[model samples]
Target chain A: MARAGLNAERLTRAGADLADELGFDQVTLSALASRFEVRVASLYSHVRGSADLRARIALFALAELADRAADALAGRSGKDALAALANVYRDYARTHPGRYAATQLRLDPETAAASAGPRHAQLTRAILRGYDLTGTDQTHAVRLLGSVFHGYVSLELGGGFDHSAPDTEETWSRILDALDSLLRNWPD
Target chain B: MARAGLNAERLTRAGADLADELGFDQVTLSALASRFEVRVASLYSHVRGSADLRARIALFALAELADRAADALAGRSGKDALAALANVYRDYARTHPGRYAATQLRLDPETAAASAGPRHAQLTRAILRGYDLTGTDQTHAVRLLGSVFHGYVSLELGGGFDHSAPDTEETWSRILDALDSLLRNWPD
Candidate 1:
């Protein structure tokens, strides 16, 4: 029989926690099973295998990130909203490095389409609405924002900014300020 | 005697190739040994273990990327120089995803300081000179540029832009143009 309370959601949550603790790439069915004090075969009832576990973690992270972004951006606009949304990502990555890493895993198109990724793109567009861009320019702006947030956070977390001067926190605030200025006066 | 052709450099190169063929996370000493038609013990003569091999790949990638960026920036400045430098990174990442991923790996402080990463920072600073930034703002600009380049390329490689409209290429060029404009008129 299955473990008394085991199910996909429970297993997924545990997997995310494990990922946060052990690093995403280190997550495996065997590790989860060991953590749960169950045999590896028991995990098959909850997840197909390593790939499925990773996909679940990815989905979990995307949804969590989107929800946090939506919360932060609920009543804000312009640079206010932009900073709010950006912090949601950077803060989450700091607090949950492994889960944050999981979000970067490449999902198949079908799976990606069904995940909260669309919400992320939409949220980005919503923020850009205050910037007065339209058509392809707006799309380009959305991508720029995405790249900045993802790239800055990734580099920061990877110690790219650790050995530098002026402190990363100061630089982050300044970068955001610069981005706000860039978006406000976006070139035609 | 050791294999006639095997050494740290040779093994590191082969490891990078293995990383490209498989994935960075999948590159292993055993796998390298298997590919070379040699025993696992024989491989130890060169690399201490998986960690050492990965570190070598990271160093190799940093140096290689630095060399390319230096070449691209040799006779350029301002927006022209920025475009050249950015293209070098985006193109290198596209052609060498695995090696590019390895570049993102966090090296120990001593190793990172010794690697060609300093050259990358110098090159970035050189690009900023044409923008008229100085002191902290120049540092901030460098960080911003790093984030955007790293962030955009990473998202592109991870297929984040695959299902989007206007095509990634359009957004890329527009982003560069926007960056050029932003740098030219950076807020005080």
Candidate 2:
């Protein structure tokens, strides 16, 4: 009965919720089917397999995150733009920890190429365009931004900032100031 | 029988190597025991269980990485220090992919407190001191350094940098230059 009502979109949303509850790694087809109280073969009509389910989750997370980034970056420029962009990720990771984890799953090259990952790069480049970086340097700056943003967020999510020092949020704000300044004065 | 010759150290090293080959998640005690041509019971004598084996691999990777950082940072300061520190991690990941993956495993707070991970933070702080920051800003700087270094290396290792543009090496150099500049002239 439930199989007739199930669709890829609904299954993927269910999978994302399951990811939030039991950590991302535990979201498998069998487990998902059991959650839906549907037989495995019945569930197969909606999801191709576990990998397909995961890819859908990843796509969902990416689109949601990209939308959030677009909102934060709107009407913001310079250091303000940088801070807002960085905050979007940190906030998302804190709020939807499961969906955030799904964003980091290994996608095949084609899936990755087609995902909202490009939107992410485009947004970063848009911010950088306001700065004075050139060709190869611009490319390098994009990579640096990607690395720092991904790195800090992942670590913070992993509790790398639970120390008795200044909280990571404060640190994150300062790093953005530093990054904005770094972009403004990229070296020769 | 081989539990007779095996101990925690050997098991940890073997686990790290196995991680390098099959990946961190794939490095199970049963798989490792088979590799050693021994029984699973023998491995238990050296390592308490699965979690213990993983913790040991994480410890081994952290220490090896820290030692490599020390060697690279010796007689180096400022930009040179940053480059040396950055290369050590990237190189380690390239050479021992599995061990690097194990290093990302979430350790228990107590185990993490007892890990060389602190020494890693200290070394990073020391490198920042070679720049000009102090107090809480130093902590921020340290977090930034950790984020960029770990983020870039992990992304590159995971093929996040295999774009149709310039190679990751060139991007890495420019990133180092950019970071050095950022550190040298951290914004107020």
Candidate 3:
């Protein structure tokens, strides 16, 4: 029988928490069921399988991140918006490492299309307006900013910058400053 | 009997090739042995195991990529250096997909310390001289550039930008331009 007070939403939230604790790879139907004091078959009722659970967590993370970005960017522009957007991603990665990792997993085109990922892109594009870019240049800038932000956060999270050379936090701020400067004087 | 003219180097190279064709995760000892017309047991004599073989391939890729970056950046500075370095990575990812992906896999500290990854950081720092950044800011810019290039390329390779946008090539150029602009006009 399905466990009392156990539902898909509760299971998905627990799965996300477990993801932050163990990692995305370690999150499984069995684990979630155990956490809820239920059986594996019971989890199958809420989640199709392990993949479905992971995908749901990914969607949750993308939405949460987009929401934070939207909130951060509100009433902000120019460098303010840029830093806000960048920080939202970096913070999310740090706070929810497992969920952040899931965001990198490849999804089917249709699933990706339906994901909250587009909202992240839109928020970034909105921030670019402060720089006066239009058309293809703006699009290009948005793509670049997304790349650098995601790339930097991914590497940093992976401990790529664990060296003794100036702490990463110091470097992150400087990079934000440089990004602002670049947008102000984009090359011809 | 071992296949005529079969050896570890050949096996590693073969594995690397298979990686390019199938992806890093798909490369396996049984598959490599099967492809080489040898039993899996016989293949064990040449390499420690699947993990060992992958590690060697990762080192091979790091050295090879560092060499390419060195050649590309030879006597180049600023935008030229940035573009060439970035291109080496992108081109390598495109041409040697498996090996490139392996480069992202976690390496043992000893192996990583011996790897040519240091050369990459040095090259990036070299490009920074053309910009006005110094001390912590320079360090930050280095990290930022690494994040963007890697993040953008990984996402693109994973088909993150395959639809609903301009061509990836255009985006790549725009990113390099943005990086150069950002670096040249670094914030105070």
Tell me which residue pairs clash in candidate 1: none
Candidate 1 lDDT over A1-188, as tens digits, reads 56457788988899999988988888888888888888889888888888998999999999999999999999999999999999999999999999999999999999999999989999999999888788999889989999999999999988898788999998889888888998888888
lDDT of 2 by residue, A11-98 (tens): 9998988888888888888878888788778777887888889989999999999999999999988878888898898889888888
Model with the higher DockQ, candidate 2 or 3: 2
lDDT of 3 by residue, A21-45 (tens): 9988789888898898887887777
Number of the predicted model whose TM-score against the real structure is largest? 1
Candidate 2: C-alpha lDDT: 0.86
Best by lDDT: 1
Candidate 3 off by > 4 Å: A1-7, A37-42, B2-8, B39-50, B129-133
Candidate 1 chain B TM? 0.97
Error of 3 at A81 (Å): 2.0
Q: Quick one: best DockQ, which candidate?
A: 1
Against the native chain B, what TM-score does each candidate's chain B reach? 0.97, 0.96, 0.94
DockQ of each: 0.90, 0.88, 0.73
Ranking of models by lDDT:
1, 2, 3
State the DockQ, from 0 to 1, for candidate 3: 0.73
Best-first order by TM-score:
1, 2, 3
